[model samples]
Target: MQNLRRFILKYHFIILFILLEVISILLLANSQRFHRNRMVNTTNDVVGKVYEWSSEVGNYFRLNSANKQLAEENAMLRQQLSVVYDTTTCTYDIIKGDTLYKYIPAQVVNNSTNQVNNYIIINKGAKDGIERDMSVISTDGIVGVVTDVSRHYASIMSLLHSKSVVGVRFKNNQEIAGLKWQTNNYRYGMVEDIPTHIVLQKGDTIVTSSHSNIFPEDLMVGTVEEFYPTAVDALNKAKIRYATDFSTLRHVYVIKDLHKPELDSLKARLQ
Candidate 1:
């Protein structure tokens, strides 16, 4: 206790000087409005700097989420680009008197290309005006036709299936034929019954024939890959390479023709 008293006595002058200095500064700030304002401004500046630093750190951490959202948006734009520039199908112009073209966009939930009787499930159904025999197509090319429907989902008969057949014609000469998959090649299908007199070339574009109501005229099917003349008959058979890559499909459009039933009834009466 005596040693502590001696130390305090020795430093008493220094401690008293510090206390006096603090009191002098406080008095100056309270007595002068200019000094008070200066202190307040200094404190605000420090707080403002701290807040700015914190906000920048938070934005840095959210960069990954922002990048993912941008990527998804870009992918959707690319799909739309393909649809707009596709030469096969006609798009709706929505003029005053035009009623020929109408399309409904949908997404694929399930698809199978390896099965014999392959099917594709879409997100649109009766609620969206989808029905049996409605044509399904992607931005690049034709996909299939709707075969079954529920309230909000529909099943489609894929073009890759062996039993699926579509009436198609050449774009150059309008020579019509039946297109069917052979089940061995997923990328190619067979076009049969084309007359031997029609001239053909490799890479000639083929499209859906207008004779049937299932698909509209000039809807792209594929390009001619190879062709051969029949051995015993005057007929030509050709292999077609599809424009759409069935293995990587995601978004598709369902086509519903409002006049389809009227057209069907007219044809039935003729028969």
Candidate 2:
């Protein structure tokens, strides 16, 4: 107590001066309208900046949850869009009967687009209703097909795979062709077996065909970039600009075809 008293006595004049300065400033601010307004504005500016900083921090933490919610919502919207069609009177309506396909939203945990057979691993698995042969798609377009699944994770055979062949048809003419990756390019793929007689314009859209149960009909695959006449006079091949940008893929939806098992069972008997 004696030491504290001595220290305070030594600095008593300095402390008194500081206190007087604070008091004078406060009194001036209260007595003058201009000073009062300036103080209020300064206080508000500091508080507003603090609030904005805190809001940015909060948003940074919410991004992952926000992404998951968006994925789930996109799945629902995609399901609704799947069977939308026009009625006899030209009114649009969803297809009758139970839902033909359901979507499961998932996030890409790992991906490789530079290899010959690019693959993606998703955060969902069998426990999440994912299964082999299910179609995977992104907001841009078709992504790949699920090839393997465990209890908590799934592997996707990306469309960039050399062996990947998706049945696609031109949006304008409905002429069918096979979409295959040539293993050399990531941005494009080859459309083989298109009839040469069918005229193709640059930027023509190619989409999935009803011929396969793996993917819904008319799902976007790519756009025709160019075409060349094949050695076989009756056929032509095309270069397509793929819809999905594999290098930046993040979220994907797995499609579950309700009747796939039944179709597989029926085909099993033939084998």
Candidate 3:
């Protein structure tokens, strides 16, 4: 008790000075309009900063939920856009009659692009109505075709694969071409069988052909970046920068062609 009294006596003057200074500032702030306004402004600034920090923390924790919600919303939009409306009828009966394709949204569980033959694995499979030969696409463009399917997963032969050939053509004049990944480049591929007479322009967009049974007509594939003739009589081949960045691929939709089975059966009869 005696030691504590001596310590307080030594530092009491300093403590008193601090307390008095605080009191003086408080009184001045209360009496002066400028000081009171400054005090209120400081308080508001501090509170605002605290609120912002708390909001950021909350958002950080909810990121997964936000992503899942976004995926679901995109899925719904894809479904709505997949249907074709036949509006030729006089009455309102045939306005919303035909649906050409159905979409099943799935997350890319695994993906590869560096190999000669790259493939993607999606979370949806037979149980989710995913089947072999179903077209896979992202928001930007076509991804691949489903090659194999299991109960809960499906493998896609990515557009980056060497054997991957998608029937494509220019959107301007519908000049048919074949799109294939001949090199290991992930950003670009080669479009073969483009006519030499069709003056190729840089940045010309290429898209899926109308005759493609796997993908709907006019689905964007890539843009032409370069072109050169392989031989004197051969068609010109052009390098195209792929629209879909496989490295950033996350969500995808598996498209089931409604009339594909019937088309396949009819083709099989010829053989």
Query: Highest lDDT, which number?
Result: 2
lDDT by residue (tens digit), candidate 1, 1-271: 9998999899999989999999988876563432111234344345434544554565566568546744775688768867766534756453435376568987666677786667777666678988778898887789998876766667778898867789998999988899999887678999888898886789999999998568988888999999887778878899999987787666688987877777889989999
lDDT of 3 by residue, 121-198 (tens): 776767898877889988778999887666666778898876677899898877998888975789999877878778
Model 3 / residue 120 / CA error / Å: 0.4
Model 2 local distance difference test score: 0.79
Q: Which residue ranges in model 1 land beyond 4 Å of their true spot?
A: 1-95, 268-271
Report every candidate's CA lDDT: 0.76, 0.79, 0.76
* Candidate 3 TM-score, true structure as reference: 0.65
Ten-residue segment with the worst summed lDDT in candidate 2? 33-42
Measured against the true structure, the TM-scores of the candidates, in listed sequence, are: 0.64, 0.66, 0.65
* Residue pairs with backbone overlap in model 1: none
